[model samples]
Target chain A: MKKLSKRIIVGVLTLMLLCSSLFIPTAKASVPYDSYTYNFWLDPVESPNPYVPKDEFTGDPTTMGKFNNPQDLFITKDGIIYVADTDNNRIVFLDTSFQYIGEITTFHNGDTFNKPQGIFVTEGNHIFVADTENQRIVEFDENKQFVREILRPETELITDNTSFRPTKVVIDGAGRIYTLAIGINSGIVELNPDGTFQGFTGASEVNINPISYVWRRYFATDEQKKRMELIIPTEYNNLFLDNEEFIYVTMGNVDVKDYGIDVIRRLNPSGINVIRDFGYGSPIGDYFVRDQQDITRFNDITVTDYQVYTALDGVNGKLFTYDYDGNLLYVFGSNGARQGNFKNAVSVEQYQGTLYVLDNGNNSITSFELTEYGSLVNNAIKLHYEGKYEESAENWQQVLKFNANSDMAYIGLGKVYLRNGEYKKAMDYFKLANNRKYYSKAFTFYRRQFLGDNFGLIMTSVVIIIICILGLRVYLKTKKINVQKREVNGI
Target chain B: MSTYISTLRYSLYVIFHPFDGFWDLKREKRGSLSAALTITGILILTYVIRRQYTAFLFNTNDIKELNLILEIISVLLPFLLWCISNWCLTTLADGEGTFKDIVIATSYSLTPLVIINLPLIPLSYLFNLEEASMYYFFLTLSIIWTVGLMIFSTMITHQYTMKKTLLTIVGILIGMAVMIFIGLLFTSIIQQIIGFFYIIYKEIVFRF
Candidate 1:
């Protein structure tokens, strides 16, 4: 009886231990979507998730009502979140903790918004709403009081048949407002501080291939010519102003071959494109596509203070983040019916390393917090940009521990090694990263070192070879003379 | 064995002095068929080595996607096509070179490619991107020299004038293209026939 009781107790204890172990959570749970970045070969390589969904804001209907087809999201410097509830015809505000601060349903003199699509908040807390259907831009003060409304410009450039429906709006640091309207292919419409019309700026140039041009000019019949697509500039879908007041615009409907040109542009005050693309691949979102519909259609773009911008693709529901040099840092997100996945992601905004994507189809704001791997990469890039190579190297090493396939980390370490006069190590890292430019720079130094080390041996070999050749020639000449003398004497 | 070595060394002389070398390569039988084939094999080996061993700064080939058989075929196919096309055109143009003569002359013309590029494989490592133009200049020079040798070999081996040789070379290129087109069409037709038989077999098996 004693043996039986002991056996029962031991079995029960073992079962309990097994159950407890099962309840313990794993170190990293699987996410609903995969994160990837393009390799040097333009192939999509899987990477660790940079940002994962932390929380979502669906809003209570009893209080501010549910978010109805929200079109835009803007996070201000004060950690406030503004959502343009397009179908609700209102703008909802929330604090960083997602607490309801207030709502803006009406402005000056009984005026209201109609399908407002875009919202921008300045440093002074003033709000600029692109009241899309109302054909005007309404401005509100920091206290939520209506300051003024800028109507459509009554200029001859905008013909009478053109309907002015501004879809996106941005205000520069100098108080100049730029709005992207429907059917305005000329360029972004610029408005003065006091609501005066300025000329269009940064108009996309029409690009027609030579073969098509010759065919259309010479071989096409009248009906065929009429059926051909007209060569015209595409309209900008959304625009954002960075800290330096440069307007960053995104065009959704652009030709795949015209990716680097009109798909995304950073326009200076004078409307010149100053975007740099020193990266391996063009900043065209996706390099490999199977079909025409697989091309990335950029819906919105958000720029951070570090010049690291993330463009949101409405089609794939992915966010492509790139550095100032247009090198793609990471890509994440997808279109699915999951908690983290978006259905129709319209806008993306970054605040304090967190990304908030507004999904029109889901009618919610999904907030993503940076993972450990993500924070490491971001810190490394920031440190490198700030000229702190040593600190960046440490961060890059940490990042490599998480993702060994990260070429960015490899290149980061290569730059540091090159700076530290470690040419051989730098060359190895650059070769692994497939960065030929930096590899050449390191090879030059490596070659110089090799030649310097073997200089004495090389000189000695040259002298010895020359002396051997001379001795051989003298010996052969004497033997030839002896043979000639023997032949003459015998004759 | 001595004859083989002598004929093999004759390629070095042929590349430099095409007019006399090609004349003797056929008339005096200084060059042999085995020697010509050996040169072709070496040229193929040179291509493979250059593709794999050239410095990363100058080599643009994706190493992961490198196919050894494709590299061999890239050299061998064009070489054989040139030989066959030249033989066919020369026969019709009242030229004197036979198929063997065309093969020997064409293979001798390729000696410069092997001579220049085999050393370039290692020399590529010694230069930087800033001095890439120097490397490219030598590469271009080797190609031009080989092409010039090929033109001269054709004229001498076939005993034709410069104009006729140039015209015959143009015809050979067009002939190569036509041959490739016909080869593709033939294979595609064969595939369709096999597919038809496969479907018929499946239908018969299913019915039974």
Candidate 2:
């Protein structure tokens, strides 16, 4: 209950902070909160994340290894984990049992990596390695052996430095790969199965450092589409692969040099949906719970049915959790610069039956068996990209057969379940990824996604809360009055 | 038309007789016309004494000044008309009184447009909702004008008022509504007839 009060107080303060007239000089002002018409943050990095990356880790977050400069992480269905061991210029793969696999430093016979940033595994063992320094997406065969480049003459997708230093790789169920191409103008690049450009969702100032999957789907009716066509661009970053969906992205990592953002943004698939935003209830400056400032500085994010998890680049090798309704659940880790301490807890992945993390500090992989939040185990991204979600959750039970701890696979399944509208499964994947703080925070934000149109929902909720509070007060008052009456009657 | 000319001749005779025979009408009609025209110059000084403000209210900025001017014109012109309409009615039609009778009848005729519009204009201010609300005032004023005009017309013509005047006005409005309903019902037929003649005229002469 006290926690609830703290949340409400924080919500009000954050709103006031946003409303406070701090002049952003170069910013040409427009209506804030009206996501329908604003552009994304470009040309600058404002703040650094407070948390340091866990450069070393072993199995159970209880242990620590000795590797540093971990940038991104992903877990496969069989509980096999992959980390973009950034500084090493290599992509590392590990199994659920904390056993190591041969690292794929190059695609085929070439030094395909300058700074390897994002890694992914597709159905039938097709692995995608994003050689960011080389500015390309490389493909490998099932044996983890080298293959040729998918999209050469990067010109088609890069379109200049806007797509420089590509980040995470998100693929649709249909085997199509998308990368968060980070640059002066950041965007998610969609690739055909043959590895060519599928055009940007939409570009120009609105999309800056977009970090998520971009798809093509329609969310509004024809009449509403005609009306908003002039205002909201047609293409959207299809974050969630559902027909009427949006992919949420985390921006402003301390890993990079941008400030101001410790932020989150969502876009529709096909690109036109450019609603760059910060989290709901952006904390007022900083809230001091203890001696340290509680910063919601967010890093990587994965969506679940009942929640979304964001890795805190701050403290507690923690994954902040939120319910789908955007309620803070828990921060599932300890606070320290050691193993299990969420030291710069940078990346989280869910696979098969477990959640995985690259404890960059311990230089080892760890997995947690998934329990609650519905049947996320079986639904993989393949089901979503294929648009065969009805049968999506079916393949997971058998696939977890290969490895008991495939974090990336579980995260992929979790996303597929989310696209299929299984939010509980989504929540489980988020929790497994060690992203409880982000989960709770994003869950709280779900309430705001439709705020202007959902006044009735908020009013009902507020009225209910107020009534409960008033009812409790009245009950206490009535009991006191009865006692007083008895004393006056000399009973 | 000739009678109208004669009525004006008598009006000049009355005003000049009451005031001064400034020019010799016996010498020539032109001299009388010239003297009357010359007399208008002396009255220019009266107009110079700041025109009276009016009571008409309008919502649109474009029409506010125009409406005020129209109100001034309505008040003063009808007053002038009152002076003359009565002179014409009594001197020519009734042939009962002199210029004094004309003044009295003309004042009575002008009362409905004035008295009702005076109270009606300020009530329009209560309709504060910018443009459409002015139309509401206009509709209200028309109903008032129609009913008030009927009352004044009956009163000036029959010399009765209070209950008798209003009941008669209500009856007139009801009769007018029925006539309007009939006209509306036949409007399409009327339009067709007009179109038919226009089309025939266009086809024959205009086309050639």
Candidate 3:
């Protein structure tokens, strides 16, 4: 009996150990970026020199050849960086290695820049600078030769009375120049390729207040009505051209309560927004913030491809990166004095795998290199979009081993299973990702399979249910008749 | 205990035979005020719990910012107001039902809804995204059953025809609205009066 009890105890101890093992959480796999505090922190690459190259005129005696409140940076396809040196009134140029190439302080035709805040370079190396203080956009050819200066046109189409102070510029494929000027609520100032004023496009709709509207219509005097502010669109903060020439514009000052207007918009040729809202909640920065001032005043947007874009918010000094479907992938860069943080992040641009953020307060550009996990995610997304689902499935599974909380990995697996016609497995993965549309597609295929297999059983159950319902109804009717008959007999 | 159990059991019978069940509940003294209040309390608990515990896939409630007191008041106040408004209107219309009858009948009519919905809170957890239709169907079924039961009880309690019962139900809804408006106006006036006293008190303190 003692031996028997000893055997039972051994068995119970083994079972307990197995159950405890199941309860223990799995340790997350090591990711290169796992050491960073932010959700998608890119490691700052050690630059040979962080300052923009200066050949002739060094900056203030203490700061040396460093920048002076540079407001924007745009990297061309050939890996050339152009900096809008706003305070110094020059457009500085740099090579891929962060070494200064040259500076454009004056035009060939004797027109010098005055506080140029925005710069854009086309594929053919045509440069466009928004000379903000000069109140005109100066264009330069690939050889740094002055092409022309575009002034605000006088046309019946221009409606806003705001002064023409162009702060940003983006040229579309159709040779349309979309400019963001100070106090311009009409829309992005669209000028024809030859600098003729094109009517406003992508004008934000004015929010109507129902209570104030009724009062104003019924009670306000004519003089009071005249004094009332004209309902106009909010000014566009910045604009960028995507790979397809679609303009992505950001608005800095927007009412938090207005759900209709998004902080970021990708406008089509006709100026209608085409970005998909993935319902991952707000597609902007942090939704639940401690203070209203913490809200992001998005100043610049940089599109790597159609699939990914990053917005640099000046207010909170945060960088919010989103996928094509409007899923916020990463949020980093807090407003702080830390090395990786930005004091006043104004613009972000990408050259190859490096992201350079321009900070106005620091007067410096910071470069961040992609970690291993970032590369893995990018490769998997690229492969999946390229229709190599099976290859991408392996990468997604590897991602899950690192971060089980990744909803995109689950979506990738769902897509793989869907392509392989494994509807049931696809449904499970899509359900995990909370993707209702894909889940419904999988359910339709699963239902067809289920019904095909159990056609006989389903028909039998349906017939049986009908008969049972009818029988129950008839039985209840007879029982009622008998009870009524008994009551009549008693009376 | 037996009387309470029987009163609760009679709710099931009343749901199927609302006309006779409501009449007997009033004329035969079959229902008790305690039992009616218990049913109403259960209804409120069911609503609150359902909003909290429903599966995330089907639950649209912003659980992060949920206010328990506000949720309870939203459900309970409307119900109590409806009962009071219906009773007042019926009294003027020469309806046979008393205040107790109206409250009891209304509470009893909610049995079908509570019965269907209480079980669904747990069952929703078992359903996947595709099987969510089952949960939705039961939700809609409970609402329809309660509405049908309410109309039937109202018709029987007042001894009115179908048309008159519908019209009276509409009038009861309007009366509930008017009561709410008056309550809001009274509260606003009280707030203004308090504000006036507060200003005078501040003036006295500052001047000294």
DockQ of all candidate complexes: 0.82, 0.01, 0.11
The runs of at least 3 residues in candidate 3 whose Cα sits more than 4 Å from the true structure, single-residue gaps closed, are A1-64, A159-163, A222-230, A454-491, B1-21, B28-57, B60-103, B114-141, B151-208
C-alpha TM-score for every candidate: 0.93, 0.37, 0.74
lDDT (Cα, tens digit) per residue for candidate 1, span B1-208: 9999999999999887888898999999999999999989999999999999999999877898999999999999999898998888899999899998899989988999999999999999999999999999989989999999999989999899999999999999999999999999999999999999999999999999
Ranking by TM-score: 1, 3, 2
How do the candidates rank by DockQ, highest first?
1, 3, 2
True contacts kept of 2: 0.00
- Could you list the chain B TM-scores for each candidate? 0.97, 0.31, 0.96
Q: lDDT tens string, model 2, A188-274?
A: 666677777665543434323332111112455667655552321112111222223455555433222233432444456665534
Which stretches of candidate 2 lie above 4 Å from their native place?
A: A1-68, A110-112, A151-163, A184-186, A202-246, A253-262, A272-294, A305-311, A314-317, A361-491, B1-208
- Whole-model lDDT values for every prediction: 0.90, 0.47, 0.78
Which candidate tops TM-score? 1
| lDDT over C-alpha atoms for residue A155 of model 1 | 80
RMSD of each: 5.3, 29.5, 9.3
Name the weakest run of 10 consecutive residues (lDDT summed) in model 2 chain A: A31-40
Ranking by lDDT: 1, 3, 2
